[model samples]
Target: MAAKRLREAEESGEPGRRAGGGLLPFGLVDVDGPSMVPTLYHGDRVVVRYGARVRPGAVLLVRHPMRQDLLVVKRATELRSKGWWLLSDNQFLGNDSRDFGPVPPELVLGRVLARVRPSVSWLAPAGRLERLLCGWPLGRVPGLAARFGLSRRLSPLR
Candidate 1:
């Protein structure tokens, strides 16, 4: 149903409408796997903004290239010749670009804004730290660390 809607939307040049018959700038998605662990978890509910500009390191909700009926959440790693090189944060658990290769931009449904519901309590501290690090004077630390090649060692997406 979603595939059909997406195809129709693309064909008609109107991809932002909800399936239930309304205009929604954003949509909700239920995370089902541990592929995005530490950032997202199983059962976590996320709000995705449609038509948002996707960049490297941004988490996105995309249709599986090989299986359009399936939806998966992963981080956009790089822009490849074929499409976008996406990767799972939990390298040990996900089947991502490493398995199916780059996905076309059309397959991307939306960019995840935030996790509305988290499945675990133990993971909150890490989430809080991430939010903190992405704000204020500390937000500049990641880029500075990246310049020193320090972030590559600490980032799980690597």
Candidate 2:
């Protein structure tokens, strides 16, 4: 399967190359938890761009430093001596850099461009509002949320 090949490539320290002799510059990753809350949610499918420039505030798909087989999505918080400090937008979620420390650059798989699945129409506006309020300063700025209507619908990628 593609996931198996990706894991193998990662473990081997090669860039996550696709099977069939072509480089995979992009990948689709499923969101599994509320760590990203307002920005992402359970079952949300994200488009991850491999080898993209990672910046503070950009969401990333990274291999767990201690458990490389596990991949997680988190926002890049800061550049640390080891690599990048990644944190969950939902502070209540404890399995981020706060617990595991900075993730080495090599473990970072890709930058999350946008959520693509579950379709925009399926996301309830009220649910988006609730998540925005719950996440507060980290998830959504109150003023921005009020003005923009708290929709997680991302623009289509060109």
Candidate 3:
């Protein structure tokens, strides 16, 4: 039924629905490497908006500066005269503008809108780990707490 609905939606040139999730504008882009770690895991899925203004501090997907067809996800650092400066959130694990310099503003594909983490059982013995995992600054506290039977705790950083 869900697939049928998706097909119908596709045929009609409208958003598709499947398994309670609607079609995405920018679609799913798998996060790889530790540059976005402690926030977006390696296998995490991100929803993006293509061709949007690359705002500073926003995560973005862009064509790798050296390799045009290769896409990379990084934080927008600065908008330079040549293009946009891209940097990674994780200083130790990222190889971004610091290495290849500014990326062509046109190569940028999209800005990340949101991400849904994989579900973890708080009732299990690894509840502490679960808290640490979902405690990133992306605003998943309520959902994480509700899923794990944990009370709202103070901000992880503060």
Against the reference, the lDDT scores of all candidates come to: 0.63, 0.63, 0.56
Candidates in order, TM-scores: namely 0.67, 0.66, 0.59
Checking candidate 2 for backbone clashes, the offending pairs are none
lDDT of 1 by residue, 8-46 (tens): 444454555553123877666667777876577677777
Candidate numbers, best TM-score first, in rank order: 1, 2, 3
> Model 1 residue 60 lDDT?
76
lDDT, residue 95, model 1? 85
Candidate 3 per-residue lDDT, tens place, 1-158, comes to 00122223334544454211344444555566677654466766665566666555556777787876456777776688888887665667546887887788877767765664453322221434544745775236456533432223211110
Please state the error at residue 53 of candidate 1 in Å: 0.4
Clashing pairs in 1: none
Best-performing candidate as measured by TM-score: 1
| Model 2 / residue 119 / CA error / Å | 3.4
Worst 10 residues of 2 by lDDT: 149-158
Two-way lDDT contest, 2 vs 3, winner: 2
